[model samples]
Target: MINLRQAVFYEYVDDGVVEIFDRYKWGLRRLGVNFSQDLLETIVYCPHNLENTFMAFCSWVLWLKSKGEKTNPEILSETLMQALKSDRGWIPYDYQKDFLAQHLDILESPQLSLWKAAGQQLGERLRNRIISDISEEGKINFHPNSILTDEEKEKIEAFKVYIDQLYL
Candidate 1:
């Protein structure tokens, strides 16, 4: 069986996954083989099996790290969607979607701040929906299909302006 802890750690790296690579690099290195190059290549080329390939790569890296092998830290996934996006060069679309759906909430939360932050980073459209969702008492929802109404859009714009003024 694959080691989940290690897999998760590697997933973090593979996705560029976050800003914690340096913090976790040493731990990953302690696991095993230098699959950084291979893993990175796979991620860039094999879009179809991105999740599985990533999971397997993470598992192997973790296993190797635990064994005191010389593994390079190179796994990363920016977001669930980015990880699951279909790549014409590899695997398949359905597989990526399925994998993303399976682990949709690895680091997500229902907090409005978190959603708002994500929305801000993602763009105004996303931020608007996030605000609307929060206003509607649907903060627990994380699906991409979630949307905001026209009123919510105005609210988001107003909020953005308010925030910008603070910076200015």
Candidate 2:
């Protein structure tokens, strides 16, 4: 079993590789070996190069596996979404969008409670951003705006679809 508590990233950077603490590296290495076989296709099709960020994501997959969840693209995408959420106050770096935890505990576990919190936070953040954008636009003209661009229309439709999937 992988030990989440021992997943540590060192400050020293060597050739852009994140150096895991000596003791923790063993567990991570074992996790990596197991992950490489099952998630090889995921890594191949991923847009970004698999680095420490990918490993961090694998940790969540490992956790989900421990809970009997199967490894699949949808599960991986959902886990990535939860990891990248801005509302996870425990993450120190604002730009860090991975599931690499500074410290692991029951509260930090990627379980039902954490997923719910992340989803709520995401909704709140989007609502606030929309309100802020409207406020910055100044006076409300209350006029019918120009026809939506194809991209804009697609985005709106996509958001609606996302909302529907949120409950599924």
Candidate 3:
């Protein structure tokens, strides 16, 4: 089981030479948000591969609920899909359509409330994670070759704004 990440970057410092870097892992770390450990382990071991879809759906559910909106399957699905299309330049989209369909089914199932509760917990973690990441920006390591360009920095800031809107 992979433990939850606690830092924005994974670094190996060998006499000031940097090696072994992964931007994908860095992005996941920066997001620093995920389902509970049990749920994450279950998703990883599940017969099907729908982890991203399930996460997006659950997070959207949590977002809507946090905004005090009563959400249904249709609303949850549509809202998530729209966010994916509109604000997902930074998010990966390699999951199959069946993955999303599975989440839609879960949304309509008797387990919806349970998942929402999990999502609520995740949202709280995400909120705190975002705050800490921003506050402790100076502590985050950057690879020598991985410095952000102006445009990349802008995009990251844009993503921060978008995520802030979602969770705020």
Task: Please write out the lDDT profile of model 2 over residues 1-168, one tens digit for every residue.
Answer: 232222323333233222232223333333333433223333233333334444455455566666787566555554544443424312223323323353232222223322333346445443333322221112212124545558645654565465445434
lDDT of 3 by residue, 1-168 (tens): 122232212342222111111211222222333434333333233332233444544544444555788755444434433433443311324443344344343333222332343235335443233332221222222233545558655654565465455444
lDDT tens readout by residue for model 1, 1-168: 122234443423343332233322332333332334434343334446543534443453344445687633233332222444545322334644454445433223324344656465546666554543442222333345656678766765665565455324
* lDDT value, candidate 2, whole model: 0.38
> What local distance difference test score does each model get?
0.42, 0.38, 0.36
C-alpha-based local distance difference test score of model 1: 0.42
> Candidate 1 vs candidate 2: which has greater TM-score?
1
Task: State the local distance difference test value for candidate 3.
Answer: 0.36
Q: Judging by lDDT against the true structure, name the best candidate.
A: 1
Poorly placed runs, candidate 3 (over 4 Å):
1-35, 49-52, 55-59, 62-138, 141-168
Of models 2 and 3, which has the larger TM-score?
3
Ranking by TM-score: 1, 3, 2
Between candidates 2 and 3, name the one with more favorable lDDT: 2
TM-scores, all candidates, are 0.23, 0.22, 0.23
In candidate 3, clashing pairs total 0
